[model samples]
Target: MKYDVAVLGAGMVGVCVAIHLLQQGRSVLLMDRNDAGEETSYGNAGLLQQEAVRPYEFPHEPSVLLPAAFNLRLDVRYHLTALPKLIQPLWSYFRHCSPRRYESIAQEYGHIINMTLACHQELISAAGAEQLIRKVGWISLYRTAKGRHKGLRTLDAYTRQGVNFKVLNGDELAEIEPAIKGHHAGGVHWQDPWIAGHPGQLVKAYTNLFKQLGGVFVQGDAGSLKRSHQQSWQLRDHQDTLLEVDEIVIALGPWSAEITARFGYRPPMFFKRGYHMHYQYPAGQPRLTRAVQDSEKGYMMTPMDAGLRICTGAELGLRDTPSTPVQIDRAEAIARKLIPLGERLDAEPWRGARPCIPDMKPIIGPLPGAPGLWCAFGHGHQGFTMGPATGKLLAAMMTGQTTDIDMSGFRAERFKKP
Candidate 1:
């Protein structure tokens, strides 16, 4: 069946785009290789933080990466097995690691991060999933005064960027979370305007709403596209099922690299697979109202209906591989250190790989050199946090509506490396 738009992914970003397009009275066919929202969307920390702090890179990143690069627990390793030719991307990363570059990138990210929380509230309320959201706040803990000092710089940076945070001492930290161990010198209590509900459920609600609004979901793998004599391109599924669409959105997460590779536009994308373990709180266990990050441990503990979840940094280069014994062990080790409500925690581990762009910013605009093709991937760690706002902007741009925020930095053409 002919559709007005075919969204080539059912992840959070793709589903949100489909919903937004449907809201604009456009027909949409949302396709995915697996169950919708069951990938990165399902197994995330589930915090909708619109902290507006800064990008992952900063001016001090060189110093930070030097030490953290070797910390397996931190999940920031570089692969020596890659070919020598990979130096270009590595060199590019090194150049961008400078504080000057980070400052510029962070400023751009701060602009978009500020818009997500409001977008989240509007969308979640419209979807009727308010119970799944919590605005309690987020905590960042440090085991040593040195870590606290590092965190202080971050706090200062955030403050300069218009993000406010409350500083808490070790005693106050214990008072706030008695279950938490370690005599942290101090910590920071940051207000994240954008907090999250159950992201998986939210995606389901959006797609369901879209279908209810007459949007179609074609459940199959989207194959290559070809231009028609009439100028519009035709999209096909794995079974050779041809469908015509006026426009298409390529929001296929990590798979976008493979999909675009066929069209001679391979992105410098890789997977940073992360793992999270959910536990059922035992009776009398302390409840964490907000998400907490163990700075030294390199993981985060977030509250959910089942219980609190603990997740850690990316496991580099193991994108499509199944969760290994090592990955699960590392996640559990970090969880055991951070979460206070884990007495009856289950042993099961949940894992997902996210599409990571080297610069840590998403490619969010019209597809490079391809008319009627748009990109919305490489969000890395912020897909859940940024998906709604991105959808609104892209949808507005597609439908000739005015955008709420400026999006000059997220141009997909940034990586025009042939």
Candidate 2:
């Protein structure tokens, strides 16, 4: 059957897009190679960050850059082979990290981030997935007084954008979370975000909601998407016609650029590969009430339904690079000392890429010169947090309605060369 629109990629972003379109009375066929949220959306720390106003930046300081360059730092790593392909976009990313440009990007980002919590809440309430979420926020553990001061300084910037956080002294921190023990100077408890027991299940809940609302889902290769002479978007699965639609949204997360480039829309994209693994605690071990991030250590231990999830920092490399889980190994060593992170639950670590663009903002809205073709990936680290907001915004843009936030700077054409 001919659908009104086809959304490629059934990750958090794409699923949300399909649901929003379906709610707007459009016949949406949600296509993905894997089940909804089974890919990058599955293996996150599971925090819906409302305080993520500032985009993650490249290290400008020589001390930070030098260690990261040699792969000495656990928070950041790079492959020697991936450097050549990434140099241009990485350089652009560096330039955007400049204080002036970063501030500008944050302003645009905050506009959308400000709407994320409410958007997700609306969907969660509708989907009856309230049991999947915990309103309790997360803690940022500072290992040193200097690190605490630096974290506060960074947090102060977010506070200007209305982010709420409470500073906890060593004694107060220990009192609140007795399970946590380390040489922590202090902690900043961000009181805005929500914790997900299972990040993938949350996506599935949303996807199920979409299905209940009459959205169609199919397994199809988004890379093979094409436009017919009649200006309709056609999707195929091994020569079997799956869908024909008036519009399509490419929300394939890390793989989004592969489809966008085919239509002459090449977003200067880079991938930040992150690792996470769950660990089983001993029988008598104290339970963590929430997720705790080692502020200086580039890792966070989140209490999930599965176990305490230890998530590592960014790895700059090709998407299909061999698993060099040095950060996971190093972060596990640090986590075991802080909390009771016993034996690993998984045989292998889960790795996924954050689809990052050079300018530190996601690409939304329609593609230039490719009418009826839209783009919705490049969310980087905040995809889960911002997916509903993106869905709401993109749906509005697609339907010619007013968006809740100003969506001028965020569009696929921004990356297109003049």
Candidate 3:
């Protein structure tokens, strides 16, 4: 059977893309090697992050870089073997972190970030996924007064861009999140973001909405995709053609490059590995009222249906590297100093990769050399938060409509002439 479009990832991004295309009068098939939302979409700190106006930058400071070089920090770790392959993209990432370039990039990124809530709100309303979302924004904790002052200043600058936030004294923070142990200074209560109590379930709800809207989702592989002489894209399983489509969108997240490489659009996409594990608080200790991120400690503690989840900082490891969960332990140790996170919920931590481009922006438009082929990936740490926005922009581009935001910055051809 032939379809108008097939999206090749069933994660939050692909599912939303299919939903949007279907809404725009396209017969779309959402394909993936695994179930929807069970991969990278499942693992996140669970914030919609409307206040994350700035793109995550690689630290150019010597004080931060020196310790991180030795893997001494809890927030970042790297795989020694991955460095050789990562040199080029990592270098570009560093270059883009320069103040002037990063500032310009953040302006463009904020255009997308600003739309995240409206986009996701539309999906949540359609899917009836309101129960999975907490409108109460997360809290950012700081230990030292100096850190709090600097952080508040940075946040104050963001406020001029129309972000909403509240400054909390140490006591106020303690009053709101009583379980957190000690804090000398204060924190920023980001009042604009939404927390996904269960990020994976939220994706499933959207997928269910896709099914209700008559969008097809199936198990398929892009590795088996090809353009027939008739100029149609076909997905295969084993020796049989699973389906054929006139157009295909590669939204395979971290694995996007592998397939795009075959089509001559391999972006300099590197992976940042992160881990999370749930823990039950001891009796009498209050559970997390809202998601809280300890900026100084480089971890996030969030409350969800499963339990209180402690998420680790970024690990600059190869995508294919075996799971190294050392960060979870370190994060848990750091968290216990503040809050009482009791027994571990899962024996093994959940790990996922964040697909990052050197310029700290996602690619979300047509594949240059490959006609009838589109691309959307490289959302980095904010994919979970911005998936719907990305989908909306891509679907509009795919259907030849004016997008909500400018599409030039996110084109797949930005890396090279491809």
Candidate 4:
């Protein structure tokens, strides 16, 4: 069978791409090895971060870099073995984090971040998944007066950018979340973003909406993609059944680099692995009404459908390497002091790799020199947040329509050497 486009990933981004293409009267085949949203899309902090105007930058200060480099920090851990392979991309990432370059990247990234809420809203309303969404935004909690002061300093820039936030003191923070038992200094409640109770379920809802609108979902290996005699792309499904398509979209998240490399396009791609574990509240312990991030400790706890999910920060390692969940262990220790967490819901920690680019922008456009091929990956931490917006942009470009925003900054050729 033939399709107008074969989206080679069933995560949030690929599913959104398929939905957008289907809406534009294109026959889309959404293919994935696993079920939709069960990968990186499943185990995030579940934040649709509208207020995250700036992308996360590499810290250059000795205070921050020394600890992370020497493996003395719980927030960021790097495998010494992976450093040899990762140095090039990490250096580029650090170079991009220079104040001048970082500002430019932030402006470019903010364009996409600004569109997240509206795009997600459209899909949420269309898919009737309002029950999964919570408008009460996430909070960044600080345990020390010095940390709160630093947070206030950071807020000035966001405030200048018109990001909405409420500065809560220790008393006010306690008032809002009385269950928290830490001697907290304060918090910054970012009011622009939305939280998801079950992020995977939200993606499933969108997938169901796509299927209802005549899109097809198939289990297939995207690595099998090849150009056929008729200049169309062909790939075999799980049953080894061949399927062909006129156009193909590489939205395979962290796995996208493998497919792109096969096509002789090497965009500097890296992955930041993270882990999450859910815990239920003990009897008489108050339930958390909002998702909270322990800013200094570098972990977040969200009220998930399974239970209170404790998610860790970035871990630099090979994608297929054995899970070293040291961050989860540290986060759990700190989280226990903040809130009463009872029994662990998941027997094991769930880990996923986030696809990232050094320039802090996603590669979302056509693959240069590869006709009928498109690339959309390297979303870093915002894949789930920016999926719909990116899908609409990619669909617009594919259909030869006017894009809603500028596409120059997100081109795939940005990483190319002159």
Candidate 5:
């Protein structure tokens, strides 16, 4: 039987597409290669900032990649065998980091960030997962004057973009988080309507809700797409199983590059691996109510139902070895810098790859070749934060409804070579 829409990749975004499509009275089928949300979506900082103004490609991010080559912990690294495959993405990264290009991308991202938190909350209510979410604002701490200066610049961008924030001094920070120890130069207290639950739990809840709302969950890996004479899509599964649908949505995250190629569109993208360390504190230890980012170290500590999590930005080349003890050790060192008792916490680190594009904005529009196919991936670090928002927008496009926000910037064809 042909379905209305078949969404590939059952991660946060994929499942969200399922739920949104179902809500619109469409016959949706969601599929994934593995258990839902176990990959990148399940483990992340889980921040949702409605007022986020700064884009991922800050002015220094592109140039930092080159200098980061020497310091594996700071930038992308590759195994000797993987060097050939890593060159193109590495160069493209630096190219996008220029101020002229980064500013343009940031402008587009600013609009997206404006709606992220609200969309997450709508999903939270739709899934009845409010107990799993927390509206606590985010705090970014700076241990150095340079980091503080960077925060000021970020604040300037936020101000220009009209994002809300409360600049806090060290003493004010102490009053809010007394357990936090360290002489912070200063901090930016920004309110982000973020979730503090198991992201995996939220994904499962969405999937379950979709199924109950009359959606089908297909368990297969989509191999390629064959266009039918009627202009529909026939998806070839791993075991040669056939599934045909009226429309197809490619919400596949990291693997989107592989899938889109069959449709004659080669996205300019790569994988940037990030790490998260989770550990339970002593029963009496103070628990943080909000998330904190140590700006200088490029890491964040988030409070979740599971435990306090310390996640770091360790971008490795696609061929780099899986995270090593030393890589996690670097995260531990940064954790100690932010949390004085990090040594006592004894957190164990978990690592995963985040799908990234050069411009650092999510690709969330139509597929290039197949008329009925759509693309919704490349969210990178903000996949969890942007998943629901992207899904709602994609659903609008698929059904020919108007989107609340301007979506011309997120077109998948934007990165296509002329």
Candidate 6:
């Protein structure tokens, strides 16, 4: 089979890319080893994070790093065995977190993030997935006065960036989210981001929309991709059939680095593994109306179609490492105090990796020196939020049209050669 473009990954980013390209009248094939949205795309906090103007940065303070060093907190944990491999990237991450560099990165990041809602809305409306979304926005809850004060300081920065929010005191928070039993000091109601009721379902809807638009999706090993004699890309499918395309896009999320490395390009890439599990609501307890993140505890409890999902903080570990759900366990213990969590819905927690770069920006353009090739990944925590926007940007670039946002900071050549 032949196609105009082959998108290797069926997560939100890859699916959206194929949709946009198909909209451009391109014959596209979207392939993934697993089902669509069942990996990293499936297990997010389900937030569209329109207010997340800034990328997550490494904390340099002694108070923050000291706990992380001992792994005493749930928000950040690292595998000792993974340290040697992570040092270079983490050091780069640290250097980029310096106030000056971080501010500049945030400005560029905000440019793309500002378009997230509109981009996703365009696809969601076309795909009939609006029912899966809630525009009530998510909240960041602080448990103590000190934490609340710190949160307010952070809000000042976001406010300056023109992000909309509401400051809620303990009483106001209780009135808004009567289901929550905690006596929180205060909360930041980020009033722009939307929440996904069922993230996986939304992705499926988008994929279905792609199919309806005449795009094909198949199960295949991206590792099977090779350069064809016709100077196109080819990959063998699960049925052992060859598929060829004039152009290829690697949007494989955390595994994207594997394919880029095969082509002799090493972008500074790493993964932050996280875990999530759902729990039923206790009898007589009201359900949470909005997704809430325990800002200090490093977990987010979002009401989902299945139940209330509790997602954990970052775990610095190898991509294929065995699951260490220590953060989930700790989160659950703390969550029970804030809300009445019922029986565990899943037998085990779902684990996925967030693809990250040291500078905390996605690499979203043609691979340097590689013609007929494009790449999009390294979204970190905002993959679900930024996918559609980046997809539109990638499609624009692929079609030789003016991009929706500036792509200077996200180029693959930004990193020093590895």
What TM value does model 6 have?
0.99
- TM-score for candidate 2, please give it: 0.98
- Ranking of models by lDDT: 6, 4, 2, 3, 5, 1
Candidate 5 segments exceeding 4 Å error: 58-67, 72-83, 224-231, 236-242, 319-321, 340-348
lDDT of each: 0.74, 0.90, 0.89, 0.91, 0.75, 0.92
TM-score of 1: 0.90
* TM-score result, candidate 4: 0.98
Tens-digit lDDT track for model 6 on 324-347?
A: 999999999988888889999999
In model 6, which residue pairs have backbone atoms overlapping below 3 Å? none
Comparing 1 and 3 by lDDT, which wins? 3
lDDT of 1 by residue, 1-418 (tens): 7888888998889988888888888888888877678888888888777774475552245566666456444544334444253456445655776877877888877777888888777777777777777777888888899889877876767778888678999998888877776677878887655345466877787677667778877667766567767767687676778888888898888788766666567777766677777777757767777778877666777777777777767665546554553644665666665555555355657767768776767888887777788888888888888887788888888898877767767877788776
Model 4 residue runs over 4 Å out of place are none
Count residue pairs with overlapping backbones in model 4. 0
lDDT of 4 at 152: 89
Ten residues in a row with the worst lDDT in model 3?
A: 233-242
lDDT of 3 by residue, 1-418 (tens): 8899999998888998899999999998988888889999999888899998898889977989999999999999999988999889999999998989998899899999999999999999999999999999998898999889868878755876789989999999989888877756889999989989899999999999999999987886778898977899878743365687999999999999999889877799999999999988688878778898889778898898889988888999899879989989988887887888789999899999999999999999888888998888999999998899998999899889999888798887789652
Backbone clash count for every predicted candidate, in the order shown = 3, 0, 1, 0, 0, 0
Q: Where is model 2 poorest over a 10-residue stretch in terms of lDDT?
A: 234-243
lDDT top scorer = 6
Error of 6 at 313 (Å): 0.7
Off by over 4 Å in 6: 416-418
TM-score winner, 3 or 6: 6
301-332 in candidate 2: lDDT tens per residue?
A: 89999988998889999987878888999999
